[model samples]
Structures are given as C-alpha cells and as structure tokens.
Target chain A: MLAALPNPQGVSVCPRRARWQLDLLLLALECVDLHASELMLQVLRELQLQGMIPNRVVFWQIRCTNPFRQVTQRTPLPLAETKALTAVVVQVARRQTAILRHLLLVLDQLQAQNLPPETYAPLAAYLDRFRRNFRKRMNLQRSSLFLYKNHQALNELGLKLLAQLLLCAGTKGMERLWFSLFDGEVS
Target chain B: MLLQRQYSLPNCTLRIEGLSGQAGAEQLDIVTCCEWEIIGQNQRIKGGKDFLVALLNSVPAAAQTWLSGVKLRRSPQYPIQVEIAAANQVSLHIPRKLLQTSPEENSESPTNDEAGETLEVHLTWLQLADLVEALDQFCSDSQTLPTLIPTFHSLPRRAIAPAVPLRKQLMPLGIGAASLAAMAAIFFHFPVPERRPPREEALPPTPEAVTPAPAPTTPNPPNP
Candidate 1:
C-alpha cells in the first residue's frame, strides 16, 4: 500500500506514472538561474507590495544546475521569508478547498473587483511562461499540492485554477489597457 | 630523449579520443592536426592525418594560430614543411630559430617508444615566451560572462488527452463504452483458434465390436 504512493522527495521532478501523458502537453520552462531562493522571494515580495496576491499560498520547486540530480534542501530559506512567497502564489489563486464556504464568494469577488485583463497581460504572460518551463513534482495524489502526504487527490483542481488565474490575468491586462486607451470601463 | 631534444623535435600528437553524443560517450583520440580538423568538422577519415598536422602546425606561429583559436604574428621569411611519415604520424621540420632549449633543471629524461623515438619537449622555453605577451595584449577585454547562448528544448506540461477516472457520475457510461470496445477489439483481433464449433468435439465416435462367436464355433467343430 505504501509502495503505491509516490516517494514524497523523489529525485524525479515529475512522477514516473504520469510521464507519458504529461510530456505531451506543451509547458514552458521557468528556469531561475540564481542558486539562492531569495531571488524568487524578492519577486513575491514585490508582487505583495502591489497587492497582486494574498500572503498565504504554497510554493514548491526543485533546485539544481542539473535538475536530473536530486533536490535536497541545500540552502534553507527562513520560514518567515518563505511565507511571503507562498502568499504571492495564493494571492492570484485563493480558492483553496479548505476555504470552501467562501469559495463562491471569492469567485464573485474575482469576477467583480479584479483588474480587467488588459492591465496585467505582460506579467501574466511571463508567469505563464515560467509555469510552462521545468517539470513540477505534480503529485497527482492530491490536487491541492499539500506539503504533507495523506492528502486526497482531486479531479484536476488547483492546476486548472492556477492556469486559469494566469490566463485571466493576461487577458484582463489586455482588456484593461485597450479599454483605458478609449477611456472605457470594463463591463 | 636528450638526443631528440638536442636535435629539436616534438613527439606528442593531438587526436580525437571520442565523439560527444554517442550512447557510450565520447573517446578522445590523440590525432594529427589535419585529422583533428576533419574530425572537428565531423567528416570521417582514418589513420595518421592527426599527428602530422599536430607536429607540423606547431612549427610556426601563423600555422599554430590557424589550428588554435589564438591570434599570432610571425616572420613570413622562412616557411617550414610539415609531413606525415612511414608510421602514419606527422613530422614537423622547423628552420632552427623556432626551436629553443629550456634550462633542463629539475627535469627527468624523456621516455622512448619501441621505434627508438623519444618524447620531445614539444614547445621549448623561448618558443613559449611570446604566448604570455600575446594573451595579455589580446584577451584583455573579454566579457564578464562566457557569453550565454540560448538553448531550445521540448518539454510538455499536461496530457494531450484528459486523465482517466473522470467524475463519479460519468463512470458507468464510461465503463460500459470501454468494455464494449475492448470486447469488439478482442473479437476482431482473434477469431476462434482451431475449433469453430464448440459442441461437435464433445464426445468421441464409438468403435464396432469384432465377431468372435463365428470363430469360436468353427474351432469347436474342428476339435469334435
């Protein structure tokens, strides 16, 4: 039974079972060349300052010059600092299943209050590009990307959510920009 | 070694040990300069074109520069001839000025091969003097980074088709469709092997009994 579950810290970025299927979809590689995790943290902090995302989201990625090599936590970032990066991810896609009671409300909020697609297209495109590149340890075991094991796998939940967020933001930016040029308000 | 040194000769040659992308990994061969050029260009050649170019190219700064990426200036007045000889190796014939002996302090004598050819300290002291000067003068303003070239690769993210085990509500229909298709494929791919009719081979045909009664009667009559 235990053998069936993926090794939580397997050296492989993606699981072996899903390789054939996953390899077929075109995803961009988001390579951050810096050895320090601080670089991504800085980007997160910058986004936080702008109120782009909330301060509680999960962020996980493998690091190494040769990604085929294993990813041990060679350079550990402090929890307080890493919290900010997590927040950045959550800011865009905040409809966690645990927050179920407020999911619809949050969805409404996004629909009503978020900036139109035109305003953030470039940044959205960049983030989308980041997501496409490099393999993620996409544990099909759970949709939420939990830090711990024993999580239930959902039917393509968070991935679709994150993808939607990136796409919407890009589309929203374009809409906002073009509309603003005409001095128009988004419907 | 001493004789080769005294005679102003070079022994070691450069060759391709291996090619990079083969499954077994590349083996670098110490070949002649011409062979090196051909190998570098990825054209196929056999034998000592490697060592010939190695020895001959080393004779002049201009010739060496052509082989090496470094830039050099030399006196054009005397040109040297580099040739490949009987053993399929290169020979460098120099005009004496290019050959300079270094101070042989704390140095061991050169080793020799079976052909009585000893290892020559290919580049002598005076021969390497201008190398430092050339590097300092020329390579001073090279970039901070080694010049990053962009690399393109194929990496797919999600499956081209939807994942298995769809929502619970859709399972029955999916399973029914799948099982029917599987049965259809099995029927088409494999017709019944030898026996088309399953019922015909159930029982074996019966054999007729031999008439021992007639033989018995005839034997009894003969005995009486």
Candidate 2:
C-alpha cells in the first residue's frame, strides 16, 4: 500500500528545506574560516604601513555616530554602494558570535604559549569593551540586515571585517609592543 | 525631500534641519541636542544642563588638555559657571552626584528644583564649530568617512596607578620551584608510561625487550 504512493524524486522533495540546510552549512564553514588572530595580524601590518594610529576614543565615537544614518545621509557612495554599506553594517552586527570566538582563540593561544600577561591584558580589556558596546548589535538576526530580498549579502561581510581590523589596529600595536618588551626581559 | 542630518553620541543625539524660507534656505537650526531618554537612567536634569553633563561625560581622558572654563547659562542674569583650569576639572561640574544627594535629603524643598534651572548651559566655540561642520557635511554629499572627533575631555586624572609587576616578583621563586617540580615529575611520572605492556605489533621490538626488564623491577619499586 505504501508502494502505491508515487515515489517523489529525491532532488525535488522539500527543495526549500534542502536549500536552508545548505545555507546553514555554508555559513558554519564560513565561520570556521574566520581566523580572527590571523586577520588582526594582517590588519596591524597594514596599519603600520599606512602610519595610522587609531585613538582609543575614535571607535567609540564612530559607534556613537549612528553608522546607519551616517552611511545613508552623509556618504556620497552610489545607491548600490549605499545598499552594500547597509548590508556590511548588518553583516558586522551579525558576525559578533564568530568575532567573539576569534577573540577567545587569541586569548587561549596567548595563555597556552605562556606569553606575558601584559601582552594580552590590553587586548582582553579591548575585547571586553567591544563585547559591551556591540552586544545588542550582535543579537540581531541576519535577515534584519537585508533591505531588499534581491540584494546580495556577499561583499558586505568582508568590508565589515576590514573596518573592524582597522579599528582595532591601535590596540593591537600597543599590545604587541608590550609583549615584545616582556618577551625580551623573559629571554 | 529636505536632507536633514542627525549625529549621535553615546548618551546624546544631535539633529539639524535646514531652515528654508520661501526664497532660499538660510541657516540650519538645531532641532534636538539632548541625551538619550532611557527610562530610570541618568539624573533627570531639565534645560541646557543635561547637554553639558552629557558633553563632559563623553570626553576622552587623553583629550583633557584643552578643557578650560565651562559656563552654563540659563538666562543672561543667572548662570552656573565652573572654571576648569589646571587645578579645577570637569568632574566638579557633573550635576548627577549633586542631584543624587539632593533627592534623599531635600526632596520637598523648592530650592532643589531651582538648582536644576540655575545651571542652563551654552555651547562653547569648539562645540558650535563642530556642530556647524557636522551640518555642513550632512548637506554636502562627498564620499568620505564621518569626522566625529569629540574635542571634549574628561576631568584630569587625580592619580596614575603604577603598572603592577606581574612576573617580576615571582620569577626567581618560580624558577627554583619549577625546576624541583620538574625533577619530581620526571622521577615519579616519566618512566611509568614506558613500562606499560605493549599490545600492538606496531610497537618496536626494543620496547618489548625493555618492557620485560621493567616488569621484574616494578615489584621492588622503591629500591631503584
């Protein structure tokens, strides 16, 4: 009697469900690739080359600047670019979980290597500040960031990562200098 | 649609709208410049005092070099003024602590309400210029990052705590303890794993030969 029921094609049945599962799997893989320490290292190198020394209060001010309104109202980025900027802001807001993981990984690695506590203390303090400031931003669902159903959310994440990388470069530099000083003394 | 600009600080939000006549737009008017109206948070200071308090609190410690006299004007006649020089700092001007203490002791007094009214604030030269620039940037569409540098600075540091020497004091003691601990660990734990009976054929024949010798010696353990 069950055989009488037409056997649905394996590819055709619950296509939506299969697609959702694929998206989630892809997202998890993407998250795994987000090596925060490596990325931060690269960012620090770039900042040093550019001679950029980010002030502690700069990011805080940037955060306060209602990034959404600033991007929308002030920026002369084309409409597409504006949309992309919105998506990036949304992506940054969404990627908090992965960012937190990366921060923890950096801390764990520092401790594991028995690096001077001075090296990681500043970083840990900064990470705590970031967590406090962006905790609410992090809780947002990925869907809320999408303005239109058709807009692709691809490049926005990369942009957000770049912004954060630039933002934290100063703190990273200070930490690196302290670490080197302590490391030499220990040796 | 008239392009209005809104800038937000952590505690305060600034909104500016261009005041346009029938012929042409003149100057932008500040529609709102007030602290975030979060319920049950922040002392409920009325008038211009709220803005000054918000400005002072937002200032970074590193930027405190330029903080001078802060004068708050409610009217031309009576103004709450605080001189922030090398000696006096911004913390003295914060109305929160004053307001907090007043409610418990003098909640019923009308003078308490008058105190809030007395400290009406006015924007200094730098603050006004910053506001003007923000409004200009909002109206002019040039692709650039928002320049939201806050010139405000917190009160001068009362004292700078010296860095704690985390590893300095403990290093010598730790070196001695660590070496002894390592020797004790090697004596007690190091040889036990090699003494385990080899199960797999993958194990080298030398380990099998050594394993037999250790088994005999394990029974009279402490003598070794």
Candidate 3:
C-alpha cells in the first residue's frame, strides 16, 4: 500500500520559491536592524510563538534554504516556519513604520528632483549595507545573481525590496504576505 | 455620565463617546457615538460603533493596494462606505439618511429621492494616516471590545499586479539619469593632467593643481 499524503489545507507546506522570497525579506529585515536574530527570538518569546520557531538553530536552518546562500539546505520549509519568519518581518517593519514612511517620502522627493538615492545619507547607508550583505552571503556564481553584477542594478533591487517590505508592514500585512507567498503556485 | 476620548493628528481627529456598561468598571464601555473630521477640509462624519469597526478592519488592506481600494460597509443600518480614491486619497460616502434631513426641506422637495443622495468627503493620505493612527489608539484602549481586534487580508494577486507597472518603469530611468549627472559633475570638477606640458613652466601651479584630486565615490559592484 502507498503511504498517505499530507492534506494540503491541514498540513500546508511552504512552496519552493517562497523560501527564496522569505530569505530575501529576512535579509531586508536584517538591513533594518543589525541585531535582527536576537530581535526575532525576543518577538517569538513575547508573542508566545516559540512553538513555531523553537530556537536559534532551527531559525538558521530555515534561513539556510535561501537558494543564493553559499551552502544551501535541501530541506523544505513548512508553513509554520514560514509564518514565524513572516511574523518577525512584520514586527520589525511595524517598529520601523515611521522611518519607512520617512524614507519613502524622501525617495519621492529625490525622484521628483532627479537626485540619486545616494544623495540621501540614510537611504545610501541602507542600500550600501544591503549590497554588502548580499555580496558576503550569496553565491555570486548563480545565474540569477549574475544579473545583479552592477552597482545600479543591486541598488535598485534594494530599493524595490525596501518598498515591498513597507507594504508588508501596512495593515493586514501578515495575511497579505502569507497569500502573496503562494501567489503563482496555487491553482 | 458620557465619556469622550479623542485622538488627534496633523490632518485628522477621531472622537469617541460612550458610557460605562452594566458589566462594571472591569469591562469595556458601551460605545454611543463615533466621529471623524478631516481637519483642513472642514468635513466631519458621525456614526456608531459599527462604522468604527468597519474602518479599523478596512484601513490596513487599503493601505497596501490603495488604488484598488477596500470598502467598509455594514448592512441596512450603517450604510456609510469608505474607499481609497487614489494613491494618497480616501473618499467617505455617508448616506443622506444619517444627515438628519430637515422636515421643512423634506416637505419642500417631496419628489427628491433620498436613496440616491450621499455626502462624499475626500481625504489626503496624511489625513488617512491620522485617522488610522487614531483608530489604532482606540483599539489599544482596555475599555474596548477585545474580540473585535483589527484584522487584515491581502487582496488577490491579480488585483495588485496592474497597480504598480507605471512606477516600476519610470523609477529606473530617473535614477539612471541622476547617476549619470553625478558622474559628469565629478568628472567636471577634476581634470586629469597630461604628461610633458611645455606650458607648465609658463604659469604658476594653483593650489588645486598641485594636489591630487580625490577618488570618485562609487559603490563597489558585487564580484562576478
């Protein structure tokens, strides 16, 4: 007899591509706060969500699924882990809501004036940090990573991710992010 | 006795009036009235608790995909509807029934259809932010309903894809132009010196010419 399969709705596992997106979001969260790992633990503890994330080792394991990572993990991420990571992202984004709003407003002003993002000190620092973090962690040999070879391309990616994170911080952010993760995968 | 609490921001003010419920001081107050005003626009709307609940639930989803908008509506009793009108605007549609139609006016215009009439108020993003902030404050108050906590749902993927294409196309061009301009400015400020100039002995070297120009600032591209 064949082994029973897990019910899709009852034991929903995260899709393959969502792992990459989740890791990118986590990377963005780290750019926002250097101590993001510790903060994630704190949030899990505070929200009584320790059951989902368990501990730091498990957290790192889930993050290791990012395809760009130098040594990628082959295991699939479950939905619970996905929710835990998303909660952390949303919490961090919520805490920085004012700053995000300010940055976006500044971006609009710069765009209107035709000034580069580098003209603004805070935004420049963020984009630079994201680029540095991306370089230090990701495998540059990957074909997808090859497209981000130029400074301008990486910076634009950073800005786009930043804006997406802002949207994730807004109302119903958790739900919005949850559904978006499964966007194309679901029939 | 009726108690009133208000949260105010730069562009909006939210006011709530209620009385203590029979459940005692430990329980939430029985909300009697809820009101919101767009500060500079000189517009205000009044409703009961249902409207407040609808607003609290609608704002977050609306904030995410603003162009498509999320509507707040509660059946026959509370017909007021709120929708995101644009990137930075919100429109509230208040039914004419809630406006306290005057008896004299009703008599003078007997043929006027009340069902088709509504008073619409437009609010800028800043004003909407203020209202959201105010509602968040209200939600945090201990005297409010614990079960009615705000919840957000993401719109369908198809609805959001069409909203962002224009911004996506225009941003890169603007940034590219700005980057080129900055590069040109740097090049203009520092001139490279050529070797073996016969005119070097004829003119005194200025302070800037004597010193080497600083390295141009550029972000290091990721290694391939």
lDDT of 2 by residue, B151-178 (tens): 3112222222113344787898999999
Candidate 1, residue B108: how far the Cα is off, in Å: 82
Predicted candidate 3 versus true structure: per-residue lDDT over B1-224, tens digit per residue: 67777878655788888776663454447777888777766656676777666566555444544421222232113355566543334676655555534434434322333555766566645455566667766776666654556543333334334334668989999999999999999999896876875654557789999899998989999899
Q: Which ranges in model 3 have alpha carbons more than 4 Å from their true place?
A: A1-8, A16-21, A34-61, A64-74, A94-98, A104-119, A128-187, B7-13, B20-32, B37-50, B63-137, B145-224
Q: Rate the local accuracy (lDDT) of all candidates.
A: 0.28, 0.30, 0.66
Write one digit per residue (lDDT tens) for candidate 1, span A90-155: 332222212221222233233345643223444334333334342243332444235323221221
lDDT of 1 by residue, B55-168 (tens): 333332322222111111222332344332211123333332232222232124332234433222222121221221221222221221112221111112221122433476
Can you write out model 3's per-residue Cα lDDT over A1-187, one digit (the tens) per residue?
Answer: 0011111332367766577777887787788667776887888788777776689888888889887798788887876667777787778778777776676667656765789988999989888899998888888899878977789888877765665676666554555566556543433
CA shift of B110, model 1, Å: 78
Clash count in backbone of candidate 2: 0
In model 1 chain B, the worst 10-residue window by lDDT is B1-10
Stretches of model 2 off by over 4 angstroms after superposition = A1-34, A44-187, B1-5, B8-35, B39-58, B62-93, B96-224
* Residue B106 local lDDT, model 1: 10
**Per-model TM-score of chain A alone?**
0.23, 0.22, 0.89
Alpha carbon deviation, residue B2, candidate 3 (Å): 2.5
